[model samples]
Target: MKKILSITLMMLAFAAGTSAQQLEKLFEKYMEDERFNYVYQKKPGMVERLNDAGSPDLWVFEKSNASLGRRMLTLNGGEKSLEESFTREVETALKADKYEQVSIVRNGKNRVETYEKITDQGIAKVNFIKNPGNIMVTLNLYAQKK
Candidate 1:
């Protein structure tokens, strides 16, 4: 049992490294979009590992090692109508044709949405959070997707 657990951890670490690389491209792509200005990103390892043995705050994307990146973005809500429009635009993009809706959880008025898409590059996992203060997105890569 110990051997099995260790091997699994090794595999996760390897995939996490690959995920770190692929998600960087996705991050750069989002940077091109004009809607977001206040952006904060922490590469895979920069943030602490997602709790595995312990309970997860949100459900996993599909399998273990599927989520590996974190990004926080803010919209310019200078005008109420503009903020609503931006929010709608982002939500629509998240549900684009290629992406599969993984899961969604609600905490009071806040909404968290997770989506994944498998491409030649890898599996892209994007998470969107709609809260009063700002919108946060945490993008992950599942490089070894079956």
Candidate 2:
């Protein structure tokens, strides 16, 4: 019984590690591509300040501490095939991370999908926005307020 428990724990740890890596690998693969624009903010506290200032997006960041910073990757003016490929990769990464789709909103040609995953360190949220010819993926991590 002890051995079984140890193995199970190990498997969970490995899953968590791999899930975190999948999204990072996807970001690395496209960050330098000329067709994509990558933005990474090292200031997780910035979100906290925004929350303090009473931003409308507070509903999502409520009772949270963004300790893991934020990253955004945008693909603009790409071919249909490229856009589709990126979308597929993002979907795969989110799935691998065990992220749950919390909400989806669509207005005309613009659509936004939000996914969230709770981790040991915090909650990770992803905002994926799709427009007529552009796709943007943003990752945010937040620790629950104690």
Candidate 3:
């Protein structure tokens, strides 16, 4: 009975690992998508010193309601092209991941787009915005394991 239980536990672990791996690959694909790369060329974690060398524009933070917490490292600003192409890329990535377009608001030159995906782990949300001068992107993963 003990041996059987051990095997079951191992299988469960493997299944969880596979799910995580698939999630990661999807993220990488989203990043590598030509539409995304064409607009924001900088890779994640490449700090930039811009206009008078202000604080690093890129930042990420994560918090959980438990003894375990996660860290979110995000990229803030980068090269920007036509707003039309960038928005298309955003929609493509989100839709491919099965995230429903939650909302999109436009206030003149500024616009915000939100997408949410329901997964076994929890809700995965992504926010994308474009202003007259720069674009902002953030990813939020809730109830995720590891």
TM-score of each: 0.54, 0.78, 0.45
lDDT of 2 at 121: 80
What's the TM for model 1? 0.54
Residues 17-62 of candidate 2: C-alpha lDDT, one tens digit per residue:
8776688788889889999999887765655556644865765565
Candidate 2 Cα misplacement greater than 4 A, ranges: 1-16, 44-63
**In model 3, where do residues sit more than 4 Å from their true spots?**
1-84, 144-146
Q: 131 in model 1: Cα distance from truth in Å?
A: 1.3
Order of models, best TM-score first: 2, 1, 3
Off by over 4 Å in 1: 1-42, 51-70, 76-78
Candidate closest to the true structure, highest lDDT: 2
Error of 2 at 141 (Å): 1.1
Q: Report the lDDT tens digits of candidate 1 across residue range 23-108.
A: 34444655757766645434444234444224454334334444444565555443567667656756655554256788899999
The whole-model lDDT of each prediction reads 0.60, 0.83, 0.52
Which pairs clash inside model 3? none
Evaluated at residue 88, the lDDT of candidate 1 is 70
Residue pairs with clashing backbones, model 2: none
lDDT of 2: 0.83
Give the lowest summed-lDDT range of ten residues in model 1.
45-54
Q: What global local distance difference test value does model 1 have?
A: 0.60
